[model samples]
Target: MIHDQTLDQATESSKAKKAVLYRMVMDKHTCPWGLKSKYLLERLGYEVEDHWLTTREQVDAFKARHGVTTTPQTFIGGKRIGGHSDLRTHFGLRLQDPKATSYRPVLAVFATGAGLALAASWAAFDTPFTLRAAEWFVSMTMMLLAMLKLQDVEQFSTMFLGYDLLAKRFVPYAYAYPVLEWTAGALMTAHALPWLSIPIGLAIGGIGGLSVFYAVYIQKRELKCACVGGSGAVPLGFVSLTENLFMVAMALWMLARMI
Candidate 1:
């Protein structure tokens, strides 16, 4: 009926902070929202009385008693806080949208690329800051981007074909784009086969950049970028254009090395 959050019951901070959480922990399925509600209460310094509805009968009975339809209900100081979303509202926190477009994936890729570049610099040149770091940053970002695309090439290709000029005209190009990007990034990072990598980067980058500009600027079409993957929420705009431009710059920089 009641699950103690901790071994000792002495840790209730204040009457105002005290919360009661009712959740389900059935044999086959444990309610996630219940877990979240309990965690949120505990983290917010509430001494939560975690009540578990272990059986369907218990759940139904509890719901009927409370006049509520959902499990994982909370009550603060004898006042029902409703569900998890309702609890969040009580704390003035914004509820996240599952379908909202975000730049988080792009930010993560760039951050990873920067970190990898720094590590590569330290290992190779005995310093974190070096000209090679910039090169590696671009190179690593491209590889990471490509890797995400490669995970579901069909999904990425389908999304990409909507805006990518070459991919739209020649469907095969959509599938090939990720492979080409990965190959170029890998070769550039490893400092292997400049003859191949440089050209590959240039072609894909140039085409991609132009397509993004045309779709976002010229056509003014609002679309989710497939830059991360098909399921990603990155918007098609400057960030996508910048990704393409970075690849082009890296390719040119590598080409200039030979000259």
Candidate 2:
């Protein structure tokens, strides 16, 4: 008896989610956003009345009647639900704000870089990867970051000068920074001459650490980090500092191992 009652209640709940979706479906072109809206409505458990305006005249009439310039308009219980984005809001889904800065790009880079490192380690040395793999990961991350900077070196240098003490004093350092990072990372990854790689890594990483510390902590300046690229929106804080610290630690470890 209880099971039957629950089934009936769920059926009634689903019945209440009725919606009307009016979208363009012409001979020359079927609206892409219209399909998206229909998919979203159906996914949200909406029993949609799919009204297709197959002709241009029909589409214009529909738009004029609804006082809307766009197709793929939805209506629930006689209330207009607008387009794909509007339906998303109606269902309480979070949308990306174009005006806002996000760290997703940088985070994606780190995640991909880590996966590459782990894969490389597994391929080179079977199960239970060693500390050398971690070193490779750090070196690879630096190389990836350098590549991003090299995409627009001038822009990167400008952003770097904002928080980098060395760059601010010697503008030429900003231009040379990416090249130095690339060289150091490549040399470290290849297990090349420690005499060159270790000192370059130590100097750059140590300076970067101090610069990040002073900019974020001491001076308390709110700024974007140039670590991932000048065009990126990655915030200047813990993550940026961690990148510098990783370089410093790797360089020191390599130096000690050599000694």
Candidate 3:
């Protein structure tokens, strides 16, 4: 199964807690996994025979002999334990799947926004269930989402360009989007400058909702959203659409207040 090691082979040897590690220690680069492996082995109370392949020639020869494409190979009682992942598996440790779809970040962000709104309401009116609190929940969420995208604008823009209709066409709008969202959200939260915030919110929200609708709901294509940021794994259909619609609603609400 894992690294071609059977259960018996993968199991730690009972005779002696000893491991042989072959890793790179070159001038320009040292294998991080190797260091991790060495540290893990040492922490586990294993006597590690740390062998450093310093030169390219030595590294190549070692790889050729072991039939391994990468270094940081571990052997326990003459059983090959493969790379860092394989080693982790051998020890029954948890490993994060980078490609796994997760909604935790989005959920956390929204939850935080709601909590902050309730707290602000408590501070302002001595109650957490005010109409103002409801408004703040939406506006604060928008600001939080904008803040996340602003963390790495370039990555957000790249992700935005992939699905956003306006970004796909104008391109520069993708880069300016986070700033616009943050500005609109901040003004809306403060209940200031409805004229500017309303227009910006309406424009971006309308375009964003349309884009999400076209790419996700209509086409039935599952896409990762750029709403919260590129690093997060928020789905594009319902949540993304909701984000846009919230802005539209907030903008309209601001307009109604002015009227």
| Number of backbone-clashing residue pairs for each candidate, in the order shown | 0, 0, 0
lDDT of 2 by residue, 137-238 (tens): 889888998999999999999899999999899999999999998999999988898899998999899999999999999999999989888888888988
TM-score of each: 0.86, 0.77, 0.69
lDDT of 1 by residue, 1-259 (tens): 1124431232343335678888999999999999988876776667788888999999999999989999789998789989989987776556888799999999999999999999999999999999989999999999999999999999999899999999888999999999999999999999899999999999999999999999999999999999999989999999999999999999999988989
How far residue 231's Cα lies from its native spot in candidate 2, in Å, is 3.5
| Local distance difference test values of all predictions, in order | 0.89, 0.85, 0.89
Write candidate 3's Cα lDDT for 1-259 as tens digits: 2243443343455225899999999999999999998986765567899999999999899889989899889998899999888888777666778777878888998999999999999999999999999999999999999999999999999999988998998999999999999999999999998889999999999999999999987888888999889887877888899999999999999899889
Task: Rank all candidate structures by their TM-score, best first, as comma-separated numbers.
Answer: 1, 2, 3
Q: Between 2 and 3, whose lDDT is larger? A: 3
Superior candidate under lDDT, 1 versus 2:
1
Inter-residue clash pairs, candidate 2: none
Q: Candidate 2, 193: how far from true, in Å?
A: 3.2
Winning model by TM-score:
1
Instruction: Report the Cα lDDT for residue 19, model 3.
Output: 92
lDDT of candidate 1 vs native? 0.89
